[model samples]
Target: MNKDIRITFRVTPEDYERIKTKADQAHMSVSAYVRAAALRHKVVVVEGLKEQTHEFKGIGRSLNQLTILAHEGRVSVVDLDSVFSALEKNYIGLCELAEQERR
Candidate 1:
């Protein structure tokens, strides 16, 4: 087993509240969250829409396969426009979500 060291630090009340809020939003304990932040690690907090998001990912995978098949002439034709548009929209939405989480 690896050994660990404990470190202590002080923060202003406002800073403490801010850290607590972020930790809550990330669904992590304050110490773990703070440690990760101090270590310059990336913290991803995926909120809600779990089932739907999973289904959306499956759809994306299918679209990717379809695109490859269409290019290979395995499929007579596939509407590339609609597929790309849907993917772009999903990408944009995820970006917006990440931006919101950052704030």
Candidate 2:
């Protein structure tokens, strides 16, 4: 989409500061943040999601290593039902959190 159009509005100093702070928190530019807000877009900022993502990456690495070991016959691969269940639970939790924030 070509966003060549521009829109301008004035706000009180306190409102400007609040909007700037929210934009910073959302890691978006002021224009983008304002545009999203004006468009009634849900801007969810879930805390610790980054850390959770990092942990998921680490789990993926460990799973990859386990797969490699199993392929080499160096280790026996057992059922991963529990692991998958936990991952799914966490995923659902995150989704619910985002939904709650949207509300």
Candidate 3:
């Protein structure tokens, strides 16, 4: 979008601070955050999600390494019931968090 137009509004200092805090949590600029809010967009702030994503990547790397080792006959494949359970739990937690934000 061109975004050639400008809109201005005034808020109390306290309101401004609250909006800024929310924007920071959402990792968006004030203008973008306000625009999304004005447009009724769903702006979700999922705390700790970035750390969880990094953990997931690490798990993926470990699984890939394990697969390679098994293929090379260097290590025997082990049960993955616990691993799957943990992943499922994390996924469900995230989903619940999102649902809470929507409400």
Candidate 4:
């Protein structure tokens, strides 16, 4: 089981309005909405970043590797589109997981 802690912070007027608007659009109270957003972002960041850390540090490096490999006749092409699709799927799944974790 996971232990939990509470946090508090102050937001500027513009950010407060933005969060409130987003909450309203989702038909949730401001607190629920903020919690949801925070959970979603945190899960995606944690799950997605693990893989990225070993990918030579960033997308530019990954692209460079792909290009270098292709130029050297080491591989036929880049599979970046598929990689991106998988990453998107991971993000969505993590977001769902976050909501579940919050509940």
The candidate that achieves the highest lDDT relative to the unseen native structure: 3
Worst 10 residues of 3 by lDDT: 41-50
Candidate 3 lDDT over 1-103, as tens digits, reads: 7899999999999999999999999999999999889889655678877766776787788789889999999999688887797788778877877787678
Candidate 1 lDDT over 30-86, as tens digits, reads: 998987898896657667446447657877799889889889989986667876777
Error of 1 at 1 (Å): 20
Per-model TM-score, in order, reads: 0.42, 0.48, 0.51, 0.36
In terms of TM-score, the best-performing candidate is 3
RMSD to the true structure for each prediction, in A, is: 13.0, 12.9, 12.8, 10.1
Alpha-carbon local distance difference test for all models: 0.80, 0.84, 0.85, 0.73
Candidate 4 residue pairs that clash? none
Global CA lDDT of candidate 1, please?
Answer: 0.80
Better of 1 and 4 by TM-score: 1
After the best TM-score superposition of candidate 2, give how far the Cα of residue 6 lies from its true spot, in angstroms: 22
lDDT of 4 by residue, 1-103 (tens): 5537767899999999999999999999998898788788744334544554444246557677888989999999555886687567666766775676566
Candidate 3 versus the native: TM-score? 0.51
